[model samples]
Target: MEPFALTVALPIFGLIALFCLPSRIANRRAKLVRNLVTTVVGVECLFALSLTVGLAVKGVPSQSIKLIEVWRDLGLNLDVFVDGAASLMLMLVSFVGFVVSRFSIRFLDGERLQGRYFRWLGFTIGAVSLMVVAGNLLLFFLAWVATSFGLHQLLLHYRHRAAAHRAAWTKFAISRFGDALLIGALALTYYAFGTFELTELFSRARDLATSASQVTASHVAIGWLLVLGAVTKSAQFPFHTWLPDTMETPTPVSALMHAGIVNAGGYLIIRMSPLVALAPTAMISLAVIGAFTACFAGVVMMTQTSVKRSLAYSTIAQMGFMMLQCGCGAFSAAMLHILAHSLYKAHAFLGSGSVVSQALATTGAKSPQPSPHLSLAYLLGAAAISAFAYAAVSSAFDVNVVTKPGGVILALVVCLALTTWGWRLLSVGEITTMLLGMTGISGLCLAYTASYLAVSHWLQATTPLFAIPPTPRFVLLAIALAFCALFWLHFVVIRRVRPNWLNSLRVHAANGFYIDTVYRRLLTPLARS
Candidate 1:
């Protein structure tokens, strides 16, 4: 009856029904069951959408309802918590589920094990919804682990492939390690503070901030430990190998991870961002790793022949951007990127598949699942970047080595990726049309990246980041003027020049320099080894 019940209960019930359905759909009865199951999922998605609309109109804090209370002696009560944050995440999950569902209508038109797929789909959306709305650490952690295991199951839904099974095992194995770390972190918090309550922890944090004691600094070690748990789960560097490998699953599931599940990392980073700030070093570690992942992954994106692998790297890059923001002490900036990127990335990946599918038609062969590029050096590069991201994203106490983080500097990293990509595409893509499409997309990315500065500006005006104000307006103004220079050249000089100088400059900016070669060189030895 409660919102949380509808949010949590209905999906769990659907999962039970789905799990009960036979694996092989041979009979009329089985087909009927599968259809009914899909219909139910559809209903759940619609309900979530309606809830989102209401939230937009009235905007209630993320709303959650707890169903049961066990272990009352231990101060453990199962509860749901919702606010703007949870609502946003739930709404994103719901919509992504529905889109994937719509896609499955055509994507899995006559597929076997339809029931298994649909059921897990419902369960995933539900678990994520529960995750967003969970009230306390116990509830959130339960949902977190459930979703993690559920993803493992979903990854292996197709029964035959050794690779699929292996990917599933990898997810499960990594998630279990992450689970242990998460539980350990929670245990420390509980032992130190005396409760497993989220609100209580926040209050405790505020009190500690006001206190003057070495013990308070010790509190930060626990916070970083918790951050480690979140990073591993979210596929931040060092642990990111599993993500692109996850492509062994169906396309829709791939979409779910990129557009929805993988986003859980961003959600956790934001949800606990306040705590992360307590250890600024850890927060910057997040940013450094994030920025490098973006830059590194983007370069790797160039090498991949398969569209899917390229897109996977793009997702990695997006995750990196979110981490960079976290590192830079731009919480809302990161949050906004997460939301915008999810929707657009979903559409882009879907569109990319369609384009690739057309290429498959030319061969008249059973369309190969796009090749998964497992580059050795890239993995190690990612590992190094992960180390940097870790330091960059940390909640820093002092500025020293923490400032350097890893991979490379953010400005250099991005300049390199964009420059390399733009130039390569310009050289390869033959027509004016292709260049336009390419530049438009690149510009959109640049806009997103630059917009952060503006938001960072406003955020600084309103709140203090490490007791320092935002960058001076003169810098931002200069950045803006630089862009204006290009705009001016585009309209005035370019037409007269006859060569479209603006287009050429766009080509130049896109090259991101010859940075890709350097990355390749850095990675070659690792790749071979």
Candidate 2:
């Protein structure tokens, strides 16, 4: 069988079995349901794994298979496009789906709604796989909508809970609005190019680039529309409240939503790199919003008391960071972020129930803060060591550093981390131990940078390298500097300062700067009416 068909078929068959099987059968033969779903998803993961391995060994094949001929003259068809990006996404979704399915087998063992949960889970996984591999705008859009509805079923699993219902409704509303923007973007793309085929659209884009018309307002509008849809889907800024509130759903659903589904926004942006990069306004908007959202979400995350809610805010921050990478034309870096975050967040959400116990276990071993007088020396040591590490890693890995703002900023972040680590080691006041610790930290930093560069290079096949616009790139650098400065200030104030004014500041930060409250007051009336 063809790879694309197999990719879509395995999951669909599982979903069909899930939907067709009787509820009575599921309840009475719960083991059967578990085995059947697990086996199906396991096989699907194997298929994706094989596809990924094949692609890795043989390189990406630029071929698509059309299953239906909608209109011969207009280039309309039901097509499954296979490429590095599609394969990577399919592998990620299927692998996560399989893991989640296995987990649910044990997690939801005796629940009355086990069958219903797996049913929607299977459908959602299948639909998202289809969306990732979709060859045209129509198929992608249709699958996108289907995935949304299917996920809604999962999100609202506890329909009796008011919070679950509210969160699901909020998600539904935002999803619908995003769906509309995607449709509009699709319509505009069709209007501009006269077809929805991905390859053909990109080919035409290349052609238009060299022409006198270069890029028109319609193309720019499409880019903005696409960004809006992505922002909403990924829960950036104001569209983000629903995600945290969505903690009312089951833990497994939270894992899936954060790890795999929410990543679609970044995927969309990266997938459309050829087009989005052409629209300066769209790029700027993505960067600005992404920067703000990252900062806002990170601050909010710090103040979150609940484990799940904190995880939710962390997701928001990570998603914003991913979007920022895309906006900076660091598509490959963004893809790396997506892949890494998906795996990490999946583990985080799945294991969140253990957080309280873990905290209790570690409560007695907290490290003491270093003296404030050492801050200046620590800062200097961090700067020097980080610079040396950057040069060493860049040379050893042969990763291009100076050419891209993303690479530069990433190196800076590595330096920041190392600097903090070095500061703590130096605070010990033992020269021999400090020297040994510094050597170990340096080696670790080298390994991390080298490994990251290697993975990013491998993923470059799927994600096109992007060039940042000067203005937005400057804005990104400014944000990075501001973040670093604020981080240092936060540490200094918390450790050294005894000012009473900061009490109110801490309160505001804890309340998310009252942004969500303001939003509720303003939007509640609209929601009621």
Candidate 3:
């Protein structure tokens, strides 16, 4: 067996082995179970890391290894695909599993269900690891469903809590809907291409792109189905209610779901970029939905009083942004976003207790607010500095901010964010502070451009870089203007510029525009049944 293949297979065999331990015995010897879990996860993490490092050094192209042939006629087989994306995801999931396992050991020290928790946790991790390396749509779909089942068990660990049950059921329902969409996509893929293997499917897609063959209706249907499936799993718009309500689960579970499982949606789109990019209408729909979800959740995140709930909304917003990146054909940026957001959210959730304590410690104190009286000239200057910094860094990395798909819009967002930060410092009215802020902004832009380029290079072999359907100039302008308006609102809110309309808007935003309430009402009859 190839080293990469062995590394990918180890976690699936080792972690799933935990399920073989008798429940009665496991509960009796909880400490032993914990030790076993830690050791297995730690070793798996090391192996995954080495595989990724080796891939990076050798710059291996994507390859698929067949492990078993279940049914040749149906194109059903067990296979593992090795590529930069899979290697990176394997390392990420394994490392996160190991950390969470260690954290759970002390966190659930006296819990009655500690052994069961570890068992399900390992199962969930194994399922995710398998999904990451699955070479065919059939195997990927199986692993996807398995992951949800494992997570369902983990969520119900606190069976005594009514809220926990409600959240878990809601999630199960949504996941099933996503599963249906994926099933539709799978059928359409087979109908259109006559193959379940990813490598062959991608090859066909590339051929169609380069040839004069017109994309058929099945291709469009598959694209839309995939978009629907991804949105549901990632908790976009109305489907995101369950995530924030899931605080009843343990912190480790929450961390795993937010940091790892939630990322599956983005990964799906990135993995199938060649196919998804074929249907411009589907891509447009994805971009619109993603942008709306990001803006909506970002507003709601500010009104949340609970730290965990805040983080949950933050995850939704981040996921939305990542989806937007995918819809824009920036698969590498989306991949980078997943990696960064996962690490950050995991740290945020695991350290939430300390965060709450620190917040309470400084409850009575108020931090300095940006001055509302700053001149418009100063704001313009800040924007100029931000744009200049981004352009300079992007040029150094040989990135075309104008012609690249969604490049201009993404650059605009980055500039807006940096401008806001610089504007705040400028409002402080300190020359030294303004200079330091500009320097920090430049450094951040440099790092952001460099990281994006590196990820793009790494994933170049796996992801397709076809010409994206051109977004209309008017549409791009509208998006830019909307972001600008949002920036102005954020500025006003932070400056304490309270008005009756602003207050009214805040109330609505705080309740997430009551979207979740409507969903609950609709689902109430079914739940009662």
Q: Each candidate: what lDDT?
A: 0.59, 0.77, 0.85
Pick the lDDT winner.
3
Judged by whole-model lDDT over C-alpha atoms, candidate 2 comes out at: 0.77
Alpha-carbon runs more than 4 Å astray in model 1: 1-42, 49-66, 212-218, 357-529
lDDT tens readout by residue for model 1, 289-393:
665566556545544567777777778777877776666665656666777888987887667667856777775533222212322232333334434433343
Which residue pairs does candidate 3 place in steric collision? Answer: none
Q: For this target, which candidate reaches the highest TM-score against the unseen true structure?
A: 3
Better structure of 2 and 3 per TM-score: 3
How far off is residue 442 in model 1, in Å? 14
Please write out the lDDT profile of model 2 over residues 358-379, one tens digit for every residue: 9898777545666566767766
Model 2 vs. true fold: TM: 0.90
Q: Which has the higher lDDT value, candidate number 1 or candidate number 3?
A: 3
Report RMSD for candidate 1: 12.2
Query: Lowest-scoring 10 consecutive residues by lDDT in candidate 1?
Result: 460-469
